[model samples]
Target chain A: MSSASPFHGLSAFPATPANIDGRVDTEALGRLLERLCEAGVASIGLLGSTGIYAYLTREERLRAVKAAVECVAGRIPLIVGAGALRTDHAVGLARDAEAAGADALLLAPVSYTPLTQEEAYEHFLAVAKATKLPVCIYNNPGTTHFTFSRELLQRLSDIETIRAVKMPLPVDGDLPGELAALREKTDLAIGYSGDWGAADALLSGADAWYSVVGGLLPRTTLGLAKAAMAGDVDGARRLDKLFAPLWQTFKAFGSIRVVYMLLEHLSLARAELPRPLLPLKSADRQRVLEIVEPLIALEGGRKS
Target chain B: MSSASPFHGLSAFPATPANIDGRVDTEALGRLLERLCEAGVASIGLLGSTGIYAYLTREERLRAVKAAVECVAGRIPLIVGAGALRTDHAVGLARDAEAAGADALLLAPVSYTPLTQEEAYEHFLAVAKATKLPVCIYNNPGTTHFTFSRELLQRLSDIETIRAVKMPLPVDGDLPGELAALREKTDLAIGYSGDWGAADALLSGADAWYSVVGGLLPRTTLGLAKAAMAGDVDGARRLDKLFAPLWQTFKAFGSIRVVYMLLEHLSLARAELPRPLLPLKSADRQRVLEIVEPLIALEGGRKS
Candidate 1:
């Protein structure tokens, strides 16, 4: 069931920064990517959920992808998010990503109207047709409100260009069993993204761990992934324990918002969430800091 | 809370037809709007949910708006959908809508990450600042996966440029109670989408009836809305019963897909849905045609 895919190891969903006028802050993003590469992050995902892909205009999104790709300078596998409600736009974005030198395209079934699994399939198929770049299905039902069942994923895996999937943790909380079942069903490279159970998922033979924490804390997150990959469950569990409080805050607030605050607190990226989404409230920010400050201190102050 | 807003009566959420290559079929759209105007639809909404605004590029969307406005020629109130996940993009679209001579802007708080009430407030406020055209909030929880509570609506109504809201049918299916409660809370004009409950929602004193059916079957839908507006409950009920089967099919499939089929069935618009969304399956299409054929016959032969 398992097969080698281009996407493996830590695929950091880097948080996108913006200027006060709502333009993508390419300089800041470039610096952020440079830091991630320096800290040993192997792969970088641009315009991901944490990148506020949904919140940027198509032009802004393209700029972010191009800037990230150029700044990374082939140092890492640059996967660009090309998710859109319409297949045409998704295809257009996929072409844009490929032309901008992205190594792969990450897609999600995002809709204002509920879509069936058949719709999701046609979407990825159309996007895959637009570019030769490998496509990674992003299945985050929490935000998408449309879940791709195992059967649908199995069918999608048959599409030649769809080489991987960044999946959400199951709702029923059966992490190991569900992961095992999906692994058994398909040869698509399986990665898990809902940051909370990442350590466990990676330890259970998941090919990649798409990390929100990796965007800002790449060194530490890379350490955790290394431990899990090495089958050092104790080391991975210890890391998860250390990050438990931060993960709790992420659950309470969103990962993007939390990451923005942490980046600002740590003086990494200029902390701003694209509008229609404000930053965490004062009390919530205080709470997050109480959980995050000690861990940042413990990580020896290396921050992107 | 009904006030004399710019939007009133049967507001048609016209489906946008496109060529197989996915470019907006402006000539076809122009012809459709001409037919709609002739059918006595006093208000035309371009790029509403039925129009597949989410599936279009910014340039494409602007072109659609311009084409609709030119075809409408100030004969009816032309409302354009300006919803986007980013406030900046939403603002840009609103400005474009105003520049293209749309009478008002219909917006939905679309997000990949769910937004808080405070965030939705800032989103609308920023858009309002961009243009003088009146803004109508589109609250469709089914697609957006984010529902606006009554409390949030009350707060939103205070924004000066926020003039109306196009609401979804309530979750509990209590149309009258929800309409009554919303009317009590704010003076902002209220309209309803969700094709299944249009008749009842209009009868309950909703200021506007935003209709997918109205775009194609304008004469008949206008009759239903008129019956409800004129306090002819019996007439409205009769129309609802006739349309019940179609609504049922719409619920099972989406209104956009069903309406595309309906428009194509009657030879009105090109019956195509954008990518990722295929046209209905054969069995479902059969079910819809059975429900729609009789009603189409009853409408006295005015086909677009």
Candidate 2:
């Protein structure tokens, strides 16, 4: 897979369910993945940032990804996240992900920076070289705290198998200008990210949205994607209006936990998240339900 | 181990050495631990924040603690860091660390927070219930991006196993005056973190110092500790002067990467840090060396 090898469209990073003892709720996670895949998820990006991969050990992560890959059975792209804070470990993850039948690797650069571009390039090159599978650069400086400069992205694009970028829009900066400039400079396939920033990113020309929101509301994502794909900008606006309130109400609890709550509300899985990260608070949960209730009800109404 | 356990004096978070391929530089690491023990390190804290525990997988972290425990041969108290964004995993690490011969644990309550005191208290309580070993509640908001407020600390103090606190000087607020008042309400073991705030904390009635600086420049830390312990403020001040300029250099590359670099400079074994984090640059190395030149040379002037 090269830069143009089309893994870009809509992707969802489904949450990994775990028992209270911290054992992977493998059965529940598999069900969640199957639901998304059955609902026509374009790609199942296992162990992505939103998957809480950082909190899970490498072995657990490998196990989850392998299970997802086996369950999905190559129906959609299985893009395993291969971003570790260290080069050797990231390479190790990439190598294992490849062995486990991951279709592509979404690699984030060394997050703790003031990383020299050379060091960042070397990290990607090492991970890219370690695996024969395609690698997409996931540049979400907002979380990873590091961004790949267009020049660095272009340098990475030089590798034959390097493909795609999942760029999260920086909160304080303008995304459209940056994406336009970045798109102009590199042949790297670009996708947008952040639930709150998705519509703006779509309007600005990113080929897909890294839909964390999609994992919670697959049909909403599909409806929005259809509207955006057909250049039906007004219809896209309507979907955004319906779904965007979620980004605000749940913003208090954080994207992951809020999404996890939404999943619980949707009856997809148990509400238990790993501790250090608790499930939504009762007061917050009540507020979240107030917001999530209507959007879910709207979906119910649409389906009817 | 209950929260009421008495803790006193210094505890050292020893570093793990690694080979070039990022495998355990076990021989080097073993030697370093033995050297630290021989130097009268009161407690051996492995895989704590200072030990880059976050950068290691569960297996790797377990292996490291086991290696350190074996090398030290029970010569010192063996405390392991068992904190992650996931609480259950933190408990698992605690149980494993104890099984591997750790005397205690240092727990950091982190990962996606807005966590109420009730949730944090429950988190600690759950970990306390899971492991047999006494746990040191790590309070470093600087890294975790969440502070354990005094009221929360007071609530945590009620727990039987939260015997100690690794107080990182607050990032914004003044060093724990009200918290110190709150501290008076409980008999918790109080230790000053060695993260550049040691001098002030020692003055503020904190017991002992767990210094990464000690891991690098033992001469400086030993001298500083001795002076501070003796109430010889001027003697501690002299050593503090030598350590001051070297402080911000590592902040440029992050504390862990800098720790590895300092290990390299000390001619102790060091290797690549784990992913999302990158290795230090040549310029960073050069600058780090330049900043610590006087301090590195201080060993030569030591009467020992």
Each prediction's DockQ?
0.68, 0.37
In lDDT terms, which candidate is top?
A: 1
> Residue A248 CA error for candidate 2 (Å)?
2.6
Clashing residue pairs, backbone N/CA/C < 3 A, model 1: A112-B143, B1-B183
Cα lDDT of model 2 by residue, A140-203, tens digit: 7655656577788888888877877888776666877877787777777788777776776776
Candidate 2, residue A274: lDDT: 63
Alpha carbon lDDT at A64, candidate 1: 90
Model 1 CA RMSD to the hidden true structure, in angstroms: 3.2
Model 2 misplaced stretches (Cα beyond 4 Å): A1-7, A21-41, A56-75, A99-101, A109-119, A141-154, A282-287, A297-304, B1-9, B20-27, B57-60, B66-75, B110-119, B176-187, B258-297, B300-304
| Local accuracy of candidate 1 as per-residue lDDT tens digits, B1-304 | 1122447888887889976556898888998898888887758889988898877778889999889888876578888899887888888899999998888889888878878778888888899889988888888887766778789899889888888998887779887888788889987888888766888888788888888888878888888989988889999999888888888887788888888877777887674787677889899889898888878887766465
lDDT for B258 in candidate 2 is 77
Q: Write the per-residue lDDT of candidate 2 for residues B1-304, one digit (tens) a residue.
A: 1222224555666666655444566677776677676676556667776677766667878888778878875466777888766776777888998788777888877644345566788888989888777778887755554567677777777888777777776556465583467567766778877457777666566776777766666655677777776777888788777788777765556667777777766666756565445566688778887887788677543222
